[model samples]
Target: MKPLVAIVGRPNVGKSTFFNRMIGERVAIVEDMPGTTRDRLYGDTDWNGREFTLIDTGGLELGSGIPVGQVGLTGQPGDLMDHVMSQAQLAIEEADVIIFMVDARSGITAADDEVADLLRRSTKPVVVAANKADNAERRLDVVEFYGLGLGEPTDISSIQGTGTGDLLDRIVEALPPASEMEEEEDENIPRIAIVGRPNVGKSSLLNAVLGFKRSIVSNVPGTTRDAIDTEVEFGEQKIKLIDTAGIRRRGRIGVGVEKYSVLRSTRAIERCDVALLLIDASEGLAAQDTHIAGIIHEMGKGVIVIVNKWDIAQEQIRAEREGIYPDPDDEIQSAESYRKALMGALKFIPYAPIIFASAKTGYHIKSILETALKISDMRYLRVPTSRLNEVVQEAVRRHHPAAVTAMKPLRVYYATQTRVNPPTFVFFVNDPRSVHFSYERYLENRLREAFSFYGTGIRIFFRARSSKEER
Candidate 1:
């Protein structure tokens, strides 16, 4: 865990925009509308040789969130504004330093004053940032924010990328000294991102795994805006779980929040050591589900297919079995058949472990963490060089590559384990092209069969041997 720094402001003050600019990606949704950001978005960056985590929060307004006793998170539902304020309040409570973003173009307003008044009561250091300062006049107008009495305001253009260096320097100065920060244990923890279509029980599964309702859970789609990272311990092993916003289909994704979600979800996959691809049990598997699976495959990520909301699907089936369902046209299938069909649809990742779970009921919830740890171990499993070549030789003996027009069959000269975490293997061969796609897949399968490389995708590459190596 790094020192937490939060960005706070009124609606449409370019808080999300400035957050995106600072993190060097559009992780937060940037719209002209107020209250666009409803959850805490987090990113890590280093400035002046110091690394810290930045939190992008929804705008602060009057009576923003629920009272301190009542929170909108977990299973409790709230109005959109209530959720926004609740998220912003959480960001404020977790920050080691707060960056107060005000609008330079709009000048200091009542909303800014309201936010300033709130921060003034906090003991944490506050740095005022006047965003949207595009020109000399706008920059000069930034001085008006000084009336907030927090500190001298820094003029910055979140879009144009100006005057941000000074902002970073100021933020660094406000951060607690290096000695007080949490130890750098991020690299050692295995990150597993729970990803899938909207309302597929991704957040529910997260809450179940942690035995608490930490993430915002609602029936509404796109409820979880940011890729929320939560760290938990499974016995002695510490793991980071990222409950990412839904990865909606490309065509249906709007140019606003949904678009930002898809990007962050994909980024979550790229960063994680393993992914839990949650499928709605009631919905079975949708085309969008496979699309997300394809992404996990292409990224060479370790994956586990979780059929969530199994309780709902089972109850519906029971009703149909009792002839209680009203709609005669709808046929109910057995859970076994559903599992087979779902597994069959994901042939590309046949090695992935599948579990039917009800996040609401805590059914098979314990297995998820245990299975994730087992799979994460495979990602780092390095086979001995000797054992790798032996498996290759046996695989080739059983089924060799087809001969190329009058040419000798492809010779497998040697092989070596190149890397782990999506274990990659390199083989020196007579001709790289001779190892066809099917043959490559066969070798991967054989490796898995020999070593039980469960729940992780493995890579194999054939390379021609150099002259000296040929000797």
Candidate 2:
């Protein structure tokens, strides 16, 4: 395992800015508002070939237990202090080194002092960063943090990217050597991340699937703020399950802990081999659901669309009141309507298989495991080279590629399976540039027809075969 470096500081102290700088991309949403980040956001960075995982945590508050009725940047009530503190504490627990950031302009405050006190209790190495030290005048502000008793504070500007190299040097020195940091391998186990918006029955689905209360399930939104991982054995297969926080739309992502929740949920998606994207059946398809599905697709993970709260959806169907059961046709009609709406919204992920389940009544919950296993198998499925070339030849013969210019028709020389786990195939052709997107889709459809790669993503790569190689 790479060393975990966590950035912790007060609200609006430029933790997100620092994270974005280190990662060389604007991942964490940065805003002028205080408490803009809520959960533990993670990113990976390497300097001088020394790679480490960085976590951006919400601002730490000291005395005030919670932010009650305080207006935030979005004009909503700020009640995330407790959640922020909890998430920060969790980050600290998981971190190998802590980068405690402080505002250079504000000088030392009670919150910084409190956070310093909290860090001193942990055995993890702590590095103090005095951010916003953009100029010579502001650089002198680093002296104020010397009283925190961690060490000489590193002065830097997150926005301007100054002094970050020295800070990273300090972190690499404080971290354990890479040889000692390597963790035992568990790559064979299939990891699944359960993700969705808040109060969408994510935790309930987890509990029902595991047949126990592995995760905290409550009616309240944002109950599970951290990505909790559990390993279980079912049908002689050991699989890792990650239950993540609900992901809301960017506009609805309230400043503070909730933002971190979204980041962690995204990280979970990145780490998983398969993602069980849960949607609320009662709520139907929403924009956020579509966005979440896009994330899974972008990650190229095997996915299963789980429609939770099927019991509640059945209650809404207006069927003949002859008995407690509904008419079979009504159920079929409702299912078809839902399938159409979902298929339309998630046309990009047409390969994802859908299952309607109810965690409350254990309805079709076991099928999730069955489908997930099939998807996992499909992800690792490899097609023989002879069989792959045969399929490609047949596809090309059926519909010749349209000419790129006027009379120069594209030619497929040969094809081979390059890799598996979202199986990738490489095709050696006359001119790789002439392979249009539609032609690529046509080839993919033909390959899928010949091979059952259901519930798994596949990639087709076109490479130019030189004349000498053709000879």
Candidate 3:
């Protein structure tokens, strides 16, 4: 799990501006978690080699005119201001390290003092950042923050990108050691995650696959509040299945355990080797379903689309078999027809194989296991350098890359597999920019053809040939 870093301060304190620069500079993990209402406030970043998630307290504003001692993080929030402060306490409670932002020009205010008191009471590691310290005069004013008693403030200009690097260095040092939070997992076993929208039969599907009631099935949405990990033996193989809470639409934390449940669902995707994406067969696919699939593809995880509640879908199909509503598009009324439309809807992840199954009756339950095992093998499949280069050279010979400029066309000298587990391949090319997006897709298709990577998303990278290699 990545360490959680909270950037806390009063509103207009440059927290959002600072957050954007950190992630926009490519110094962060750019893969987004869809449907998060706090998307802007939450960002995944890394300094040196240590990656951590940044939680911006931009929305946690303490309204003006409130006295220092009157404000409190206790009890449930009443008004909008109290609601925002309640969220601030949420960040404070979950963060492994805190980055307290302050304005150098304004000096310390009552809000800043209250925030400092909140941090001091928690006793967590705090790194003070004095924003707007662009000039020598403002830099001198940074000392006023030291009086807040957090520590010596790091002077920075979030807009100009001055002193942010040193501030990042301090933030990295203050983070808890990486090993302390690492949860060990068995590499030999194939870890699978059952994920989809709420009430889509994710828990029920897990129970069907296990041939027993493992997760509590319910009609209510967002029933499971946390990730449930269970290890069991299927046939001769031992595998781990992670059942997570349902993710609500629009990133809204409405009722009970909203934040914790959503966090668990996203974290489950991060740790899984293969994701079993369940979709409702009766309602077909929706926008939220595709959003979840997009996140899975972006993470480069092996995925198998399970159309849950097919039994219910069959009942609906039976009613419409006589062409009650004639439609040319959906001419055939069978699984084959539904599959064609399903593939069209999920054209982005065309590589993922879809399985139509019912969680109630245990239909096609064995095939799910078989396909998952096959995908696990495909994710870790490696091709030898000689065979890879031969395939690449043949692919280029068949259809040469289009010329981006009149002077130089794209030329690939050699290619090799650099990593496995969603296998990544690196190609030494004459010019990386000359390779277009469509050409990359063509290459990926050819590689999939040669290697038969059915359900796993593979990675391909192109880099300029080194001068030494050119010689």
Candidate 4:
């Protein structure tokens, strides 16, 4: 269990910069403009041997703070500042410790003073950070924040990495001790990560499932820069829906934070129980989708193929109609053929169950949840050693491994299930190199056929047996 510390303040107050600095990574998108970070981005941080999760929230404006009883912040009628204030108020309620960041270079603005007044009423411990104090001149400006009455302002530069240690130390001290509620213990909770290229409705699907606008959905690509987790109980099952950054192909990623985001997404797949590999139904799958699916397969995580924006897809199909398909069933068959073609484009993830969904319209969203639960169940399946051996023998008998270099035939001595989650199997063979990739695929297919391990990725390892060990 780790304490939850939320970084809160007005827009462009260097909150995202401070968050990225505290996490020791560029988990949040740092932009010069305000209102860039619309949703709360969660990342883990360790300070003084105490680990905690940090949440970077949208900036708060003045006077629009929602009352405590509402689900979240309600926008005020008057101006933009009011909406920002309401969001900040909502952030205060969610945080265990609030790191109220302000710009020292700009000195204190009226919005800062208004947010400070709101923080004064919060029961949570607050650490006022005067960011962008990179030099001695700005350090004097840091003193001006004391007028807010929240105590001393810790001057630090988030970009230059100056004086952040003291700020983190103060933050750790202010954070409540880690508790059991923060720790996740449920093995049955299906961790489904929603992943896709940018602006493909990954966040929208998450929001639809939660039945609220949980993650920030914008028309802009790359709006979501960090992975966000939200738990929802869907149809008698508890699922942890993870929305990850839209991943681009390795070569296409420019340098800096965008590249780091792709790396983070790879790590997210490794940690997740199942990956909801989302693709734009209207645009269809691309080379990047195959690359992402390959990562999921390599990690041996269960996968569910989510084709988002299906409503748009239907309209597109209707526009493309020709005299070739006169009947409705024929049109459906044509659409199914088109889907199969898309699946062919993403052939790397052959085992994943594909579902058509519109995250915006909430079309077939329930099926997505059902598919995730099925995949999670499949990942945890355990086949008995005896059953596995029988399947292996039958498979080998049906299709033997090809002979290596025309010298000797590859013989599989025995096979056993090595792990349950993701269902890994190890086969002892006469020569590991002699066992070809096609043969491994054959064995996996056979195992799936025998045990019904559908919607789960399977891994197979071949170990060469020494002469002495064989004897």
Candidate 5:
């Protein structure tokens, strides 16, 4: 519950650059391109031990009609101005204080005046920041912003990090006192993280499941910038659904903002009990898709693979129905071929259940909630000590561990369930170092076969135990 401070300005006014400077990280995408950032991006930072949450918002532009041409002062494009304005307005509503940024190099323009007037009626503490004033020579440019009536503009450079310390001090002074902030109680609920690359229908799937427009959906890739959490009741169970920003490959992630989005998505995975890993059905599996699935495996979280946009794939098959398959019965064979290819590509997480869905048409969408609940229950399944040891003993009898040398052979004395929620087990062995990865994997497979761990990952550990302790 830290105090909220939002950075607001027109397109390409160095708002994101200033945001990155304040947060001390490149969290926002900073390109010369206007409207690159379409959603509000948030981060937390402390100034002189006082902490606050900062929101970097898209450029605010008003008017209902399609914005034509470019602004005279900044010469920045205004396409998608309405959406960007909506994003900014939402940020402003959630913020405790507002930092209105203007371009120092280009000087104030008509757009700046419009934003200034908007802030005047809002009744919030507003700070005017004239950015790109790298040196004392451009300090005179900030004088023009004084006309906005928000007081003298703070001369600073987001890129060079000049005059920002004073701006931080001013912002901290304007924030609400610590006593006024309220603390939120922790809730024990199942959190499902919807994760995938951009344009993979992750947001669409969420909207489909919710049966309403809970999140803003657009054809634009990366439309959802922040990790938005929504709580819903499914029968008697209350579940938390976290809709995260689309994660792009590390190399393709643009400078500043999009990079921070990937970080948020990764954090969501760490917090969730189960993850819905979505892949484009028409495009099939890409290397990045595999990369995302690997992350879920490495995190030891339960997962469900969703092949989204299945309707598109279905249509493609129908169009070439006669050409691809002479017999109508062969459609089943063609479908199996598609599923088999996905299995081969994602062999690492063979435990995950795959569902072919179309968010656009609501095909197989309802099953996702039921499937996630089942997987979550499996993740927390605990096995009794006696049963666990019996499984381990049977596994050992089937295939003995290889000997370290001709004279010394590996021996497992006993095993016990150490924990649940990923179902960890510890095996007491004569020599822990003698156990190899292949043998460990084999034991995991044996455990999976004996028990229905369905959609969750399992962990197995080996520990050396002396004969005296065993006796």
Candidate 6:
């Protein structure tokens, strides 16, 4: 588990600005007006080599300041103070580390001193950041905050990006290392990531597989704001499924927490073994779906296309069967046409296996898990040199590559598998430029046909043969 750091202080003390600066992005809304931040904004921040989640909360006050006639409130009773104490008390309990922010220009207020006294009783580590110290005059004003009894203040101008690195180093020093966190692990577990646009039944799929409510499911879009990871054993294999927030196009991503969600989803894709690209079968494919497939291809990870809401598709097919249909071969052609259309939407990920299922009813859900494991296994497959050469020869015979100028019969001297996990092959050729994309695709197809490397993408590299003296 990542360390949790909570930023707490009185209103208008620049807590949100400090939060946005710490995460290296504009995750929190920073407004000059007080009471602007009402909800909690969460984001990930890495300091030095340690990563921690930062939670920004609204400003706290010791009391509601309700008039005596307003809510029949008496004087400053202990009960009224207890209510305000509970709010700050809750933040201290949840935080692994606390950052008490105060405005250097404004100096310390009665509210700031009240909260300081409360935090002094808690054992949580606290760092006091003096915000808006943009000039030497303001820097000198930070000295007055030492009386709050939270140690010397670390001055920062969050809006101008000043002094944050030094503050981060101090924050990292307060956090515990990863080894002390006791993260659970299983051997050779396949890490599967369910990724798609907003409200595409990703959480529903996770709930169906777990046979319980592992994640909160709702009809609302972008309900999931963080990447929630859970593990389960399917058959003999242990799988770690990471359900990430819905990803939006870069231009459409609004500022604040929504933008941070997109960043988290991108990070999740980079760390997974196989990405299950979920698409709504009812809505078919969209431009955003194609964009996501492009990211997966560029990452060189294995992919599986899951067309969810299959129950709805089957109902539509049943209604269509009642009408006058064409010949059997025409029907087969139509099926192939529809398949090609879906494949065209994900053209960048041509090797991915597409499965139709309904995450709601658990329809074909088992097969989806099985396919992910098989694809992960295939991604790590290594081909023998003798078999690789045979496939190369067959590919050359079918569609020979054009010869480079001044080179005699551009020959491929040998082919060998250089690496697995997205299985890369290197071809030592007499003329590397002679190998065209068409011939390369032909060679890949032949290799796939010879060796059942389905559901896995292959990469090929061509290098010119060394001269006789150099060899």
Model 6, global lDDT:
0.78
Q: How many pairs in model 4 have backbone atoms within 3 A of each other, for residues 3 or more apart or on separate chains, i.e. clashes? A: 4
Residue 162, model 6: lDDT of: 87
TM of each candidate vs. truth: 0.61, 0.80, 0.81, 0.61, 0.62, 0.61
lDDT of 4 at 336: 85
Report lDDT (Cα) of residue 225, candidate 1: 80
Q: Taking the tens digit of each residue's C-alpha lDDT, what string does model 5 give over 1-471?
A: 578788887788888888888888887788886655644567789998888878776544323222222344455544444544454455456678888888889887776776676777777788888999987778886898889988878999989889899898889888888878753424346789999999999889889888899999988888888889999888888889999889887656653345457767876887788999999988899999999999899888999999899879877777777545346666467668878998999998899999988999998887988999998888888888899788889989989988765435778888888888778999999888788888899898988998888998888889889778978
Model 6 regions more than 4 Å off: 1-103, 108-127, 146-151, 158-162, 178-184, 211-217, 222-230, 248-271, 294-300, 316-338, 382-471
lDDT of 3 by residue, 402-469 (tens): 89875379999999999998899999999999998999999999999999998998999999999998
Per-residue lDDT over 189-223 for candidate 6, one digit per residue giving the tens place of the 0 to 100 score: 88888899999999999999999998989999888
Which residue window of length 10 is worst by lDDT in model 3? 28-37
Error of 4 at 445 (Å): 1.3
Residue pairs clashing, model 4:
60-84, 61-84, 61-85, 62-81
Q: What clash pairs does model 5 have?
A: 28-256, 28-257, 29-256, 29-257
lDDT of 4 by residue, 150-191 (tens): 999999998898988998899888877666434554787878
| Candidate 2 lDDT, 149-261, residue by residue in tens | 98899999999999999999999999988988864538678888999989989899889888899999999999998899999887898888999999988767654556567
lDDT of 4: 0.78
Q: Write down the RMSD of all candidates, one decimal each.
A: 8.8, 4.6, 5.8, 9.9, 8.4, 8.6
Give the lDDT of residue 324 in candidate 5: 57
Which pairs in model 6 have colliding backbones? none
1-471, model 1: which lDDT tens digit per residue?
468788877678898888888788888888887656655466788898998878675543224333222334433444544434444455556578988888899897765676676778878889899999999999988888878998799999988989999999999998998887744546668999999999998888899889899999999999998899999998999999999999887656543345457667877897788999999988879999999999899888889999888878867886767956545343234656876897799999998888888899999888988999898888989899988888889888899789776556788888999988889999899888676788888888899899999999888888998878877
**What lDDT score goes with residue 437 in model 3?**
91
- How far residue 56's Cα lies from its native spot in candidate 4, in Å, is 24
TM-score of 2: 0.80
